[model samples]
Target: MEMKNNTVEVNHIRKAYGNRAVVNDLSFVVKPGEIFGLIGPNGAGKTTTIRMMMDIIKPDSGEVKILGETLTEGAKNNIGYLPEERGLYKKLSVIDSIIYFASLKGVDAKTAGKRAEELLKRVDMIGHRQKKIEELSRGMGQIIQVIVTIIHSPQLIILDEPTASLDPVNAQLLKEIMLDLRKQGKTVIMSTHRMNEIEEMCDRILMINKGRLVLYGDIPSIKAKYRNNSVLIEFQGELGEIPGVTEKRPHDHAVELMLDNKTTPQMVLETLVHKRINVNRFELSTPSLNEIFIKVAGDERE
Candidate 1:
């Protein structure tokens, strides 16, 4: 796609606080109509990078182009941002608060109200629309925060730790909204601690650590790069310490193994069978996004 058609472009962006670099020579592209994930461990500079993109903070060097233009007040209306630190007018009614925010994005009050009603209903928050934001629970309030972000129907939406306050059910609803936005040809940048969210929702991901890019690619390609020679086994009783197993984890009903190099699932099964161990099922697979995240973030296990 042409540069003009892209949702965001970061060209060698760099940011610093004092003598320490917060973001170091970071560069990436977010295509139109795709969910792009930005993730890293604590203090990974993910927030700093996002701040630069939003123009909430400026980069020390390089540039960020949003919707083919430098981030400006006019350009700001085209991008919706849901901050990790959620806030809402406590005394204002939920619907009213969202409508007010929508107006700030240049949406008319009437249209904003209508959109708020529809969105609230979709999130199962319609009944509470007229209630004060302080009246809602943390999770319900978070749902409103999402509605507030997109009330004006921005072309690109940035969500930071959006599901932090949601339960599984509400989180699933948020995922549906994300897919719906993509279906409508809008781009989404999501920062989440939930690796499952990235795997299920993101098309591409950029992972950083200590202000440096550690991984940048589509989800499938990154997973393939970090693929492990491993197998999942559902068996009964002790397997008597199978050979070629570098790591073994016993869950409630099964075990997952990390196999060493040159080790194959077939060889593992043969050894199990030879030892007279009962094997119910087994399958070889690549490492999960969580595993890759741990490794990339320098938090891997022994």
Candidate 2:
């Protein structure tokens, strides 16, 4: 199947087993060169939804379009997927394992070999190319898995917990690779629970809770939608004497204040000046994705 700019379009998909529905009328689109996130708590049907998208399991209802065509045998070659489950031969050498997986995706031996070496180097695993998978650390194995996923240079890349076992430094490296892929015009679908990763890497997000779509949109807009209209202040002097400050929470390097109903930020600044509270900085606080996720997902559980 020939590929199109619309890498993925899931329309009202429903998946059920026995008497229970796992996914209920889920619909979303992943545009070209965009990093889209599918996030939810455990048992939220995230894995099932991704499986349906990859055609590993058929959905009970609705449609999934990949590269503007219904997912099929030929369509698989145009997509790359790193499943949550790790699948690697423990006895196989790093280079051989990557080549083996790449070959399954229709990559030629020579091309796969060359690409494997390049990817290993890119991920800083070239020095261990000849080492057995069993000899490598969990983080090293995860890097190899990522290499295998992108060996064919698929138009759409789907990664499930891509950095789950990686250290902070390696996790940041993988994130950079994802951004580089986007720069090359490849669409990426990232499924992870790390709110910070979604905030920094994803262009848009689809948040599912208990198989239902709870939130979907660009990051900034979503944050703005849930903002509490509060201000954050950093001061050297005492803030307890400020009469207008109704509530305060001490953060690592600053304090977050909840202003009174009638008090404006200007009034708070004036009060600080009058009290000589050596104000260093004052800014409006926006709701973080983590906060929004907890609020939206947690409230539903109640």
Candidate 3:
């Protein structure tokens, strides 16, 4: 298929079961050649939103646009999806299963076989191409599923926890693959609980909480949006009686001080100098995605 600027536009999609709403008026845009992440704690409607985008499940209300059109059977063929749940047939050989899935996406046998060989080599699973699905480890099986998902070279890829069962090494390999896909101008939408992955891999993120959009923007902007303007200061000598220090969290090597209103970092530095404490590194602490997740998701997990 000839590639275009394959963007995903979700405009107020809603899915509910009876009186409960699993996804409520969620909207976001994923641009082409970008790695966009849909992230939230479990049961926060991440899966429902992804399913609706893929047309796997019809939304109770609202629409999903993929590649500039309403999602349909043809649109689906342009997507490579790896769901969180494993779906490989244990009875089939790994290469056979991969080819089968590629064929479903309209790839011919010859092209599928060639691409499967290359992908297996890329994933360092070339030797196990003929192995049965049941013989491979859980991590290996996950890798095979990922290969199957992208065999057809779809313009848009959707991965749900793509590294669920893999070790750190394999997980890193998957991250590299995702980056390669983006370099090839493919739009990727990945859902993962790994905040580190989202931080390192995604260009933009959409955070959903209680089935509603809590945050959506570029990573730096999102982090900046939640920044508390707190700074961490490490001092050797006793620097007691600081006026601006509202609260202090003592770590083994440093202390993170929450400043009081109208207090400046320069003031803290001057106080440390006046106290004659051996000051070490001083830097602002930006909120991580994990912290942002907690702050936005609230105590719902409890």
- Give the per-residue lDDT of model 2 (tens digit) for 1-302: 34445779999999998978899999999988899999998889999999999999999999999988898887898889999987799999988888888888889889999988888888877899999999998888888888889999999999988988889988988999999999998999999999999988999999998888999989999988887756898889666666667788889899888878788778878888888888788988898899999999889999
Model 3 reaches what TM-score against the true structure? Answer: 0.93
Q: lDDT of all the models against the reference?
A: 0.89, 0.89, 0.88
Pairs clashing within candidate 3: none
Report the Cα RMSD per candidate. 3.6, 3.1, 2.2
**Pairs in steric clash, model 2:** none
lDDT tens digits, residue span 239-295, model 3: 688888888888678888889878888888888888888988887788899999988
Candidate 2's C-alpha runs over 4 A off are 1-4, 234-280
Alpha-carbon runs more than 4 Å astray in model 1: 1-4, 230-282, 299-302
- Give every collision pair in model 1: none
Query: Candidate 1, residue 280: CA error in Å?
Result: 6.9
lDDT of 1 by residue, 88-120 (tens): 989999978998898889999999988888898
